[model samples]
Target: MGEKTLEEISKAMRDIDITMLSTYAANGAIASRPMSNNRDVDYEGDSYFFTWENAHMVGEIENNQNVSLSYQGHKHFLIAAEGKAQVIRDKHAFKEHWNADLDKWFENGIDTPGVVMIRVDATRLHYWDGMDEGEIVLS
Candidate 1:
C-alpha cells in the first residue's frame, strides 16, 4: 500500500531469477536481453550478472553505463531499476559471485578467457503490483 524498505523489495525480488537488462546499442536503439541472476538476489541496491567481455552487451555498457533492468514475477508483480553498470574483469571478484551453474557457459570457470562480471549499482527502483506501487531511491 505504501512505501517499502530495501529489505522488503529484496524479498519480493528473490524469486525473480532473470531480469531483462536494457542498454543502448551503437545505433542508439534500445537493446535488451535476459540475464540470469544466479539466485544472487540478496538485492542491496546492487545486482550482478556474468557475460563475456566481447559480448555486445559489454560494448553497450562501455559506451554508456546508464542501464535498466526489468523483472516480472508471479501474480503480476513487476520491478524496474535504473543504474550505472560497471564491467569487472578481476578473477578474484568473479570468484565471489560465481556458481557451478555458470560452468555450463564458461567451461574453464572464472579463468575462462574474456569472462567478465557486470555490476549494476542501482540508483532508483520502482515497483508495481495491481493497486500497490512505490519507488526506492538509492542515490
Candidate 2:
C-alpha cells in the first residue's frame, strides 16, 4: 500500500469519535487529555472544538508545535504531528467550527470571547489493527 497522506489521515479520522490529545510544557512535561469531536469528522480542516484561551494545553502548543492525537475503534492508531497553534480570534474560523452546545461556556455562541481554534499539521502515523484471529487478507 502507498503511504498515507494528510488528507488520508483526516479521512481515516472519520472512523472514530474521541481522540487523546497530547501536549507538553516548557519543563518537558507531557500531558494528555480526552477530547471529543465537535462533529463526526471534526479533525478535518474545519474541525471545531473549543478550549479556553488560557488553558495549559493551549499554551504548550503555542510554545511548541510537537503534539499527538490518537483514536481507537476496532483498532489502535496514533497521529503524530508538529504545528504551531495560536488563538484564532477571527470569527469566521470560529463560526466554521462552532457548535451550539459551546454556548454553555461562550454565552455569545460562536462570538464568545477567549474561544480559540487549534490548527494541527499532521506529520506521522503509527497504527495497527489487531481485531482479528490472525493476519487476514481481503480483495
Candidate 3:
C-alpha cells in the first residue's frame, strides 16, 4: 500500500464541496449530517470543523470518536474518509472558522461560551468515480 500524495488529496477535496459526517448515539443508531468543508485545510494533517458543544452532534461525537465522512458531487466523484474527531479548545482556531453565520448561534461573537471546533485526523480515504473509475485509490 502507498500513501496518497498531498496534491492528489487536495485535488479531491477541491473537486468536492460537501462532506456527510456520520456519527452514532449511545443506542447505536446512526446519524449523518452534511457539513461544509473548511476549504482551507484540504491536504493538511488535520481537517477542521466548527460545531457547538451543546449541539446534538457533539453528544454523538463524544459517544463515539470514530467517524466516517463522505463527499460526492455532480462530477461523479465520491470520497469517504474514516477518522477520529477531537474537540479543540484553542481560541485562535475557533476565531479562524468563525463567520457571521456563527453569530446567529453565539451571542458573544467568535469567543462564545460553548463554541467548539473538531479536528479530524483521517486514517483512510477511499475515492471513486472521478477521472479514473475502478481505481479504488486509498489515502
Candidate 4:
C-alpha cells in the first residue's frame, strides 16, 4: 500500500528462482529466455545468471547491455526490473556465485570451458502485489 524499500524488495525476491531475461537482439527483435537465479537473491539491485560464452544471449548483451528481468512471486506479486547486463569471464568471480545445482547444466561445474556469468545491475524496478503497486529506483 506504500513505497517499496530495497530491503523489502530483496526479501521478496529470495523466493523467486527464475526470471525472464529480456534483451534486444541484433536483428532488431526482443529476445527473452528463462534464467535461473540459483537462489542467490541477496539482491542489492544486482542479479547474476550463468550461461555459455557462445550463447546468443551473450552476443545480444554485447550489442546492447540494456536488459530487463521479470519475476513472478507467490500471492500474485510480480517484478519487472530494467538494468544493464555484463558478461563476466573471470573464474574467480564465478566461484563466488557457483552452486551445486548448476552442475546439472554445466558439466565439470565452474571448470566448464564455455561457462560465463551474466550480471544485471538494476536501474529501476517496478512491482505489483495483487492490487498494490510500487517502484524502486537505484543509483
The most accurate candidate by lDDT is: 4
Cα-based lDDT at residue 71, candidate 2: 66
Of the two candidates 1 and 3, the one with more favorable TM-score, higher being better, is 1
lDDT (Cα, tens digit) per residue for candidate 3, span 1-139? 3345656667768756578888886789888888766564456546777777887778888778988888785567666787888777788878766666656666887677887888778777766654553323334
lDDT of 4: 0.95
Q: What tens-digit string does per-residue lDDT give for candidate 4 at 82-132? A: 999999999999999999999999999989999999999999999998998
C-alpha RMSD for every candidate: 1.0, 5.9, 3.4, 0.9
lDDT of each: 0.93, 0.61, 0.71, 0.95
In model 3, which residue pairs have backbone atoms overlapping below 3 Å?
none
> For candidate 1, lDDT tens digit of each residue in 41-91?
888888999999889999999999999999998898899999999999999
- Report the C-alpha displacement of residue 111, candidate 3, in angstroms: 1.0
The true-versus-predicted C-alpha distance at residue 68 of model 2, in Å, is 0.8
Ranking by TM-score: 4, 1, 3, 2
Q: Give the better candidate number (1 or 2) by TM-score.
A: 1
TM-score of 4: 0.97
Clashing pairs in 2: none
Weakest 10 consecutive residues, lDDT, candidate 4?
Answer: 1-10
Clashes of each: 0, 0, 0, 0
- lDDT score of model 1? 0.93
Q: For residues 1-139, write the lDDT of model 2, one tens digit per residue.
A: 3354446556767776677778888899989887766654734333334677888888887788677766676455544333334456677877766767667778988666777777554444544444322111211
Location of the lowest summed lDDT over 10 successive residues in candidate 3:
130-139
